[model samples]
Target: MMSGPAQKYVYTKLDQIKEGTVVNLYGVVKFFKVPYRSKGTDYCSTVTIMDQSNAKLTCTFFSGNQDTLPKIYSIGDIVRFHRIKITQFNSEFLGISSNGFSALVFEGTAGAPALPRTSSKTYSFTEEDHKIVESLRIWQMGQQTFSNLRLKLSDIKPEQYFNLICHLVGKAVLDKACYLLKVWDGSKCALPAWKVCVEEEALEGDADFLSLHQHLTVDVLVYDNHVEAAKSLKVGSYIVIQNLHAKLHNTCNENQAENSYLEFHLHGGTLYGRGITILPENDIDVQELQKVLTTVNLNEEPICSEDLTSHNRLSQKSPPFNALERCQQLSVTVLPTRQEWLTTPLSTVVKMKPPQKYRVRVRLRIFQPQHLYQSVKLHCTKCSSLQAVPDEERLDNILQGNYTNCPDTDAQNAYWYQSVKWKRNQENRTVTIHFMKKHDMLQIPQESLIMVEGGTFKEFCKLSRKFNSIIPVTCNQANLELDLSAPFLVQGNIWHYGCRNCSSLKSIEALSSLTLEGSWNATEIAKALGIKPLTYVFVMNLTLEDETGSLNAYLWRRAAEQFFQISASEIFMVNNLQEQLNVIMTTLCPPGKSIGEYPWMDCCIKSYHSCDGREEQNLYEIFDTLIS
Candidate 1:
């Protein structure tokens, strides 16, 4: 170590020497910045080094000492600069910058400094830094530290600064205290004291100048000579700010916090005109963040074992939200954003603007699993809805948890509709319109129609089981008991279209107001009406059957729109002989069997009592023609 009691040698510690001294030091590089001028004069790079005890020193180059300015040092790089000289810079103010000195650039092989690998552990504030901040409250004088604990800042009047960082962590967003910040490092929480006077430029693609939750690991830089350093703090970063003065008498205004005045103050550490260096951690990869992000499901539970569960729970399994198969897909972006609603209180519900409505349109592409494509409902006001804000604003508001309203209705019963898209078959998909609003149970229950447009053999079985199991139970409760005891039909009233034995049928005077229960099946309707079952086959059967077009080109094409209009009390199976014959003659007959069979075999036996083979064949053709 170079120790001197002479004119050229100042009385300072061996670690403080940057040039003209032979001192040995071991510390981590906290900040590294290369200095350059517009005239192409590249000066030496400077670094803030902290030793084993977390003590800091400013290492700089002497005037005209150009050899130390090369790429020998970087932030987060730990090095041992050996056999170097030490001297302070020439400046009007002596104490802080006076310790500035530099060293020779280390070569790769010869005279290269020994670099150390950094670990995951973070350094905590020294006892002295904490004491200085706490001491500010008791003293009227302002004092700051530029060294590890050197008082580089002062001028604070008594009790001007917040004693502990905890006071600001979850407080309501305040306007006063220019440097107010609530920062966390995944484990510990800290308030990053900021100087409100400085303006911060936004992150690369964001608009919020002071937003800091995206980057994850960052340092808050403070510099005595420059303003740029103080304005560069980012989101998701961890930083420790030291050696800057705390204003002694600053008080947030009693009315508006942003208008308060600082009685005592310190130069922002970020303004020291220094560049902050960040060392990369092991878990900084994208995969690591993926593990932390989670998906949430919000829908009703299954009404019955057979009924389709409220909605498909499949998430697109790509990078973000992927699913197993291709389905009818649409993206919905709603507001206060689901995240914002969660953070705001119920009473503060007035802050939210009225719900906005959106339209959803879906069409059947493939035809396998039968599905419905049109539905509408209101959306829920909750944590997820608030998350729909722009990416930048989403960062600060994600965890606020103010979800307290229904996002679907207005005071006078006006409803805002939300859209839902789901897969039914590769061919036909379902679309539902929904919104979050106050429901009127007195007007209508949630019983909507379940129409299957196109379905496969497997899907048909599933739908059949679901329809037979659940729908009848709900219908039996809604009807059945009203008409058995009373009959009101006495004449040619149009209301006589319903069950003659039930009085409820008399109440349905118009089709628009009637809430009748009904079931539909392509196969069943085809058999009863003497049409081909070609429409019952969807995309899946088209591949297997390789079938094309209709059995009868004119009639089969129009069968889907034709209704089989069923009564609520009717059973699923055919009970009468005419209905039974319709199934056997039209639906059960093989595709080409009709042309070869005796035409009137069924009717001739009933009418003529007996017939010759030729007459029977002719009569069979006529019977087949009528039902087929």
Candidate 2:
């Protein structure tokens, strides 16, 4: 006779349970519950039984009665419940509560043997979770471990989960718009605090596969001020999301919504891990894991189809400056280095041999009739240097327009750099010229057959119309031949300049150009010519001496006015004392082709005490007026 009724259910795993069979599984009771909205309100606690294989069976204790079960059926606590309804919700095993099966019996075993489990460490979620939350809109990237702590859910935003660890445990699936759950280590909390996403294939036993109740376990991420329907989690299905972040959501009146979260910024200091471990609780070395991950990423190869092709074209080009190295080595004459000023005292003049004179032919080209009418000649004498002319005497001559006269009573007195006679051809043309002797002309016979070549003959004629000779006047007596085909010699000095191989006198036969050889110094000039015992090579001194024998007076005023002003810088001539008294009348003379614009006048003014005297007289006049 078949038993009329079987009261005791035994030896059935929740995962292997078939329909029409009641299974009694003895395991630690894993509880979960919905959160209470208020202190006086209540929420249901759900319990679970998992066989040794980690497969689970779900059970729910409705509110109002489950408060007593917490004292005995706490999470991780082994227990047995009787009179449970054996039912299959979708394909998964679920136990329903009966009014008669309220108490936890001390002994009754079913699915797995009753066992104890350890509590897992948990961590609080942070804002970094929102950075890569795209999969769940608020899910963490993923981590290997967890800790239990009050997490901030509202901090999660959409599409931003990258680096965070999350822990979630709840019923895997829900039906009839209701389910039961309880946190493993913490108080029962609502699953609505998270957002849910689930794979349809994971839940196949549903009557209507896409139905909300058919969802096995809601997939979700936590967000907002409260848990959403999706975030309401379950037991036996925990999620550890990683890499989360936070950002502004919205605002409110007077009280900003941004300030709503009391503990939104929650980042747990990692414990139990070494060297920046994301899964510190696990025994795996983080360095090994990183290396494995990096290698896996590196081994991935790109795929290409058989017909793929890409092409690039190139052109030949040439470089610039290809011949630059060859151009720098061509012929070029280099001048001597410029002279540095000597620092010796003016009074300590060293008596030395005069600068030698290399005979240079100078052909003076006269522009006006007067210079051309007169015979062009340069007079040289073996003379001694007379004493310097007083400034008063020079000033009187300049004021009286006697610059053409010599101030010294002795007619033979002469000073270096002083031009005895100088005349200009026209404002547009230069009148007088001088230059060194040409070496080629020195070797020719006195009456040699001179062959005119190229345009040299015509050039020589133009130059010969202005000067008596091309060689220096000092070399006039030298036995030298003539080469009319030569280019005219040009000279630069204090008063005269121009092509010197021109016609200065009619009777003057045959002129040739000359070029000075050697430096403007004495020994070199003397050595260039085949002359012996060469006299002096004139050089103008810029420094002057005083009448009291001091070196700072107007001793070199003549040289300074000629050389310093002409060669060094522009020369300004003061012609009259009365006019000079009127603002020290200074005039900048145009550069004469001879010596160029020099600082001659400036040097003269500096050497003499005339400027000092005038300034003192002006001061004295002012004092007299003030005292009067």
Which one wins on lDDT? Answer: 2
Which 10 successive residues of model 2 have the least lDDT summed? 619-628
TM-score of each: 0.21, 0.18
* Local lDDT at 583 for model 2: 20
Q: After superposition, how far is residue 333 of candidate 2 from its true place, in Å?
A: 92
Candidate 2 wrongly placed segments (more than 4 Å): 1-12, 28-31, 35-43, 63-79, 99-628
Q: What lDDT is reached at residue 59 by model 1?
A: 64
- Highest TM-score: which candidate? 1
- Measured over all alpha carbons after superposition, the RMSD of each candidate to the real structure, in angstroms, is 37.6, 48.7
Against the true structure, candidate 1 has what lDDT? 0.24
lDDT of 2: 0.26
